[model samples]
Target: LGLASCKNNTETLGSPLPLNKNYFENYLNARYNEEADYDPNSPANILREVHGLNKQGKLITQVSMFANRYPSEDALKLFGANEGVGAQLPQ
Candidate 1:
């Protein structure tokens, strides 16, 4: 019964959205519990992170840019595949 309920909950949540500015905002909120303020648009908040926002404000980090033109789960998969294959990337 618990497993079935959890499945239904996940189904109702729908498909996951790609990593984007809004997602980053929510993540920061959850991670810091609103104690440490973070601005998703600030370079300081994004520079050291795994994701980056382009001029148009999308999570298309320097690394993921080579994988796909747009941000999506498939892009992440492609990036992972490239890493797995030991693709040489610029420093």
Candidate 2:
């Protein structure tokens, strides 16, 4: 199903697809593939990232220091968090 490339190259990420083909780019958008391959709502294949807890600890969150990603630093600081979400919807 896949082919290996540069076996001695440690810096490489993973095995290449094949001649003139890319599996990740082609199958990444399939919902059934992602759910069946991994699990429910894994977010591994998602591109839009709203917030994420960089640390694995129970009370830790890795919010972006920049303004656009998350602007609610106060709520995050309540638990030493790092990020939050800011979405506006029309009524």
Each prediction's TM-score versus the true structure:
0.18, 0.15
Candidate 1 residue 70 Cα shift, in angstroms, is: 14
lDDT of 1 by residue, 1-91 (tens): 3543344232232434334665456545542121234456566656645454332333322321232234465445443343324333345
The lDDT per prediction is 0.42, 0.33
Deviation from native of the Cα of residue 30 in model 1, angstroms: 1.2
Residues 1-91, candidate 2, lDDT per residue (tens digit)?
8886666545543543222123334444333211123332455423223354332212333432223322244334334121222322223
* Root mean square deviation (Cα) for candidate 1: 19.7
Q: Give Cα distance to truth, residue 60, candidate 2, Å.
A: 36
Most accurate candidate by lDDT: 1
Worst 10 residues of 2 by lDDT: 80-89
